[model samples]
Target chain A: MQNKLHYEFEHQAMATQFSIQIVGEEYEDAETASMLCFQRLDALELVLSRFVPDSDISRINRMKSGDELLLDFETWDVLKKAIAIHQKTDGAFDIGVAEYVDVFRATKQGILSDFEMVNALQSVFKKAQNASIYVDPETPKIYCVQEGMTFDLGAIGKGFALDQLSELLEELSIKNYVINAGNSSVLAKGVSKNASCWSFPISSAREEFAVQLNNSAVSATGTFFQGDHIFDPRIGQNICNSMYERVWVSSQSAALSDAYSTACFLLEKEQFNELLQNNSEIAWIAISENGKIQFFTQKNIPLAQYLIS
Target chain B: MLAGTGLVLANPFTASASVLSANDKVNVAIVGCGGRGSGMIFNNIPKIPSANLVAVCDIVESRREKARDRFYTLFDKKIKAYENFYEMLEKENLDAVVLATPDFWHMQHSVDAMEAGLHVYCEKAMSNKLEDAKKMAQVMKKTGKLLQIGRQRRSNDRYRFTHQILLEREKMFGRLTHAMGQWNRSKIWTMKPNKQDKIDISKLKQYGFDTVDQVYNWRNYTKLGGGVVSDLGSHQIDIFNWFLGSYPHTIYATGNNSYFNFEQADTMATILEYDTPNGPAIGIYENISNSRAIGVYERFIGDNGAFIISEGKDNKIYRESRVKSDVWQKYIDAGYISNMADMKKYKAKQSGDSGIMETAPQISYNINEMRDMDKVYNLPAHTAHLYNFIESVRGEETLNYDAETSYKSEVCIYKIHEAINAGGAKVTIDPLEYIV
Candidate 1:
């Protein structure tokens, strides 16, 4: 293990940051592999960065009011996944919320009048029904039957990145590693310097470092910074901030962990508990609004069990 | 006279003003004083001057006692404890509200605090989801309230410095063609089920039950929280947008509940594409649930050179100076190497940890680049950002990371999730989409 070539690379992505640690047999080979992984990630960003003007997504957004745009491979791919999650969660999770929400944002910035914003958002909602979106996996084409339709992927992009990074790492034959998009979404394959499983502290201690971690998925989606900013697009109202407010999902893939955490956060109690019952592997600890920290898991594992075991 | 509790700084912007004047103190009240609320109490108290903990509110009496005791022990401050957050807000007359509540309650508490004419320092990921984020922003605007998001990175120096260097410079990072970041964790393990006898069992399906598992562990389920992406990814993705100069044009993602068979995906990956005026850039990100082989805390790659950043850790830059590489040998022979070298040599450089802590040195172009205070500051941009925000509020300078700039990151992260949900397809990131 000591002789094994392990290289670590760090990049600022998502909003937080990322640290990628890869271990292989040769140092030069590992560094090259890390570089390759970084390059692949770069390619992924080119096709997707919203800041770019000519990007496929940006072009679509820049399309004139009546213009019809052809969807790119990556855009179409995101549309398909959105539909699946929306369907799976019975629309509990929907990217369509962006259409209504952006108008609200403009209004707050004084770019749009309140009435204009409302009317504009209502127009979008009305057109939403007319908007026909279809993705053909064969040709990988995403077509919008209605010109008014728009797609948003704020919920699951990190997961997709994780999957891509994982495949890239695997392709590089780099076996023991982890790629984290910001401590929230991550892909981990092996243990760390410590022999024990990586332990993530659930308390709101604000420590910059992790406690103990090795070969496990941990994600905490707590409304720590922005208050009830996550509005349900279905209804342009803020959802109730629950006592059990943070959703930490642990799974095999960081993508899954990130996605499920988002999905679960959107789900109600019956749906959430039902999913937990069916899937016993994931466990969550939430800090209640009442200052009580509760634990919900498929099993009866206590916080103490993980903390002190 | 700032006649409220928690008025720690005279003003973050105007450094000329004495922040720790013996008479100037910030009187604050902690709502939902649990782990996070208490943690915030500890985290900020030491940084600010004379921040008196005026009150503590918690639904649980015992928890309130624990907080009060801790506050007393930590700062020798007597805290008035309460059972209801609303009651505390109505009566406390605090300078600010530290809303350390759950995802669902953040909106209400923040709105209430703002309406009460108090400054609010809320925690990260903003609200649980997009709607909540918007509402919170709206309320802040309407109230003209000093709403400081708990995204400490907004206050940290490391993150801000990178944004300045990569963005403000003349394509200094060389068109920032590609970027990738990740957060890897070991086994987060499991939280034990709350004892069944504590409360109503049927309420587990409700939106706001106070059960141990339901309230404290509500984030594990959906309705109560926005999952890990909204919770954790929001922060990092926000940084991505800030440094990249805009939102992601396209995004694609996927995840599974393989490890923690919860309703949500425990682990996931995202691919974000940025469309520059020149061409395109890409960002690849990831989050894992089960394993903990943490690596590459943060990396920003560009056409000319790349930068690697970490919090409280050294941020290093590695130039793609291998101009004579196999693929680039032809270009090198064609005179691209000389121009590249000249550009690289002239770029302003400030490699280390931007005066936060001694780390590695940052390499950039020449003295011209050094003029921009942002790059000179480098990562840990949060410190400057906080100071800026306070300064803006205190009539010092404008808050650079206002709703608009902050929204850029929001829109980008949302686009990434949207793109990935489409099975790694592309999607428009512009805000002017034809409605829904």
Candidate 2:
């Protein structure tokens, strides 16, 4: 027997699986809303996916120096958030490290020889030094003043998609729902019939916990999920000596939770403590490499207040 | 309208239409504020620099208003909204209209727009009924206006390059013997009733829908759509007729209304037999509403090589092992195609391999035009299709998939529907039937 009488639907987009659960809605209505949401997601993928040749991101990647391209509004929205996160994290989270990330990934997959890997890294570092991309604040336009940079939204794309879906759900009058993007970023709204909040099991190297979510989002990133592919873009190197094994960010917005979870993972313990102090509303959980656990939150924060095993 | 040609024009808005001068922006309106219509309003139309979306029309008042408000918020431009098509036609000063409504409405909306001295980019399968689709082409001929059917692949740079440069020019896929395609979906779309819908049920009947579900999930209903065959198969079948350079001489199909169990809808698997200039060939297509296995793409195979192309991810060209690698070196050097990998050449000088010898990967190549175009996302095929229509309106470029050519593809699609509906029967099509 199930505790909730909700409908669940799954879709694939942004190269990841996504699932939506609608609570207390009629099946016909839930299915319809999900289908529409998936369609919107597909459209977003077309505009956002780098693999999509004519997508705004791909066009931006291929732009010459001093080239400007009008962007799809959705891409513009994502870039706006990404720029904010990049600034707030003070270079810890950067989308411009796509070249370096690609080299590291290829090296990890055994596709690059030792000599080729060093040369590739050196080449990307030189390119990064000379490249800077900007988004138009007033319109959906991206300008590449010194082009030769690529961007991959794999870090925050699904979270951004969840936030967009949440808007659509609100338009559809679907108030009570839980939506997840491949279980990495999840947004919960309202309360289900049987439970006061939605709960998802989360883990790191050792510590296991579940966060109860209501009208909020939880995003986690670590070796458990990201598999050491996480790179510190500021230094042009990997996070070889990280204080934490896994970290989760709980925010009212999925895009924030997702992007910052990564930023938080890359941040040192002191830097994260400072970030927490600056953003009082954001709560976090960290599982250390040695299996120690920590929670940073307020007294009544949903994540801390409703923490479960 | 035409200097007193003894015919009264149906449009009350304008007299005779003048050709848009070079560099003149096209005033456009989109009718049918449904899913596809919303896509055009939100995604495609906004991307085209030469298009000015001035108005929108839908039978559902809320949908029309929502589309208008959303378009304004996203693009920072206000557009008028109308619940009736004729009112939008009469009030809005427009050069063209995009018909993204249900398949049943494509013909009527297209004919009305053409009659109103406006170019049209109508979504395809053209119409639910063959006669209606044929009538739409006839109206285009009568109006002498441009009609670009939404077989968007026809305008895709990859598909165009594959057909025109590779297959036709370089003979990449030599002596084309067979082609196959599939459009598989996990489930048929079923939309929920709008919670904020304010329209009266009586008014819904005026839009060719009995209930709101029919309006929302039109493809599942017989009266509003032609089910899986026409809805999904049409796009791929059009490619078969196009890339093969001829319409199918005969079609055989099998399908069942087992899943979803909608009144008259069915899952279809069809085989279209064609006689091409190269030789006789078979084009196989299947549209399954229940399983999304293999995704959506079209594949064409020949003696020399084979290639698969789609608006989605599948884009690859394979060389036959029986053919010498030197035969393709010229193409690679000319930037026609690039070798994906040359393992045989790499292994000739490299170290030894593992004991287990796996299946050798297909020596594949990718078309270069597609590659270069893929490097930039400025002119997606859908946007290019609309651009082609607007450019044609300005006399800059002719229509790529004109009404008559699209009508020919429809003749083949409708025959597949007929063959399936008749329980796997083989339907022969006279080549004259495709002449419109």
Candidate 3:
């Protein structure tokens, strides 16, 4: 049996903490590889971050209606993924929530007064349904068909960064790695030493539970940190008082898992079950406001039995 | 002026009092009114209380005029514009002059200004030629005038604190082993001149510029600039030499103009070998003009800890995991280092460990604001460098990078350029060559 050593590196990116852990024998190579991975994340942030005044996404948001802007391949790919997930989640995942996000951030910074907040929120909600963003399927160009349309990639950027990190690590030929971004999004490959699967702890207000994951991505979304920061694009309002305090989704793709976890947080039980039935690759665990935990999975092995044995 | 503010010795070395008060203002002029020269006029000089913009000088008439117009628009001071630097020096009673000319012209302009009994703050890559750089330092020695090089990182508060307080006093990042730095950017650095701001062709030809584009993008030429190695790598490599307290003994470098078909190399990498007091160390630096992937920063790694410091907001200090956490805890408690993750802002409901899990322990330091009595200011690094020069001229502060010290790093840079131009050859340096 080969003895494996665990090495981790931490960096701040995309306004959140990112960590990469690799179980390997070559520690120095792993350290160098981790830095290179973070460099890739830095490049992605420069393209996807809306806070950067000159980022491609920020430039797109600033474009006038009927103006077409060419994008970098990475930016175009992420936006296409976002559009696909938006349709799959039945309008649950939307990137055109920058208007409400701006107001919320301004209010949090104490820059907006109560009356101004009310007016901004009403205006954002009014324009929420008419998000006329168009993307050319053949070319890497996006045209904003309606004025006042903007994008905030906050919900999916972390996952996209993780995907990029995974590609970088794979390119370096370093396997058996786990990447986590701010404890909200996670992706794992191979397995930890002496274990068939990588184990992570999921906790609610009442109790804590451990889940085993292998070659899969998991993301947990909740209102526990920033109150009501998550917005529902369908109604253009924050889902502040949802029944579930937290929702965790595990799937084959981090972007899909992240988008679904966010979408499932505001969904009713029946709606979530129906969505899960259609997407067999996704499994979810939700913790309610009353501290009740519910588990739903499509795998042949029962999750409760797997947890016990 | 003497009635309101008490008169003091205008020149400490001279016997004449001149009835000059400390607040009487130091008359200043600029020798090259290009982008960098005009930037100092617009961005830095206004922030300095003791500086007075007296004259602008450039071979190109439009550049000097534009600089004159900018200073007048910003400060409402109608400064005189001159076509020749020596003529400006002969006419204006300037206490100091900023040399922002091309790398090839820095030696002559700075030497003339200092010989004329005026202090000089010359922009870096001190000169495109090493012999000229050496002569400039010799003139500063013979003239007994202050010559400040524009290595702005030396004046930055964070870098100062890192060098003077953290490394020198506290022995932080003990026994630095290796240093790495990079500056990457996309696109060619070309400027489009306004139609109204165009200079005549004969004027540009007389100024030794073949075209207007050469005047704007002089950095892309070998005669006017130092290519990527000296233009970008010198600034970061100077930090390695300063922090390591040693000049490189051997250098191996390779560069090419593959990305941009300009006269200068667009991409370059150099390996610098240093023998510090603690042990032998090395420095690696690279500059790529085709991709701004990692941006720009310098990283110094030691046995105990490491730090990534830049003029940008990406500055951070990290403690090695092998070091005792309690040793770093003191810094965190003293506010020298703060957790990179702002755990205070968010409350985790079910906490075993709420944040991302890490196998290695890392602690990061955030840049703290500079606090005066009631006013707190976080001046940019370039402004601080200019402020330092202005204060040094008043005999209030010593220069952070004197010509003699800066010449040592320039020697190393020129060696790398030699190796790169020789098609990736290794060059050795005599220890005596490091001294001016």
**Model 3: what TM-score?**
0.57
Over 4 Å off, model 2: A1-4, A97-111, A204-206, A239-242, A279-281, A298-309, B1-23, B336-363, B368-377
Q: Higher-TM-score candidate among 1 and 2? A: 2
Distance from true location, Cα of B101 in model 3, Å: 1.2
**2 versus 3: better lDDT goes to:** 2
Model 1 misplaced stretches (Cα beyond 4 Å): A1-309, B1-21, B165-167, B192-207, B312-314, B322-400, B415-426, B433-436
Error of 3 at A170 (Å): 49
Q: Candidate 2 at residue B371, lDDT? A: 38
lDDT of 3 by residue, B1-436 (tens): 1111011111212232211123758899977876568667865676566778789888777678878886675456789999877778888899999988889889988998889899999999899999999999999999999999998878766677777666776787899999999998765555444334557778877677888777767898888888788878889999999889889999999998888889888988999999998899999999988776677899999998988887543567777888987787666666555553322222222222433332322436553322221211133456668778888888877888899999999999999889988999999999999888
Q: Write the per-residue lDDT of candidate 1 for residues B54-111, one digit (tens) a residue.
A: 8887665556776777666644557788867777877876776666777777777887
lDDT of 2 by residue, B138-167 (tens): 999999988889878787777777777788
Best by TM-score: 2
Name every residue pair that clashes in candidate 2. A54-B377
Candidate ordering by TM-score (highest first): 2, 3, 1
Question: Which lDDT value does model 1 have at B356?
Answer: 33
lDDT of each: 0.55, 0.77, 0.75
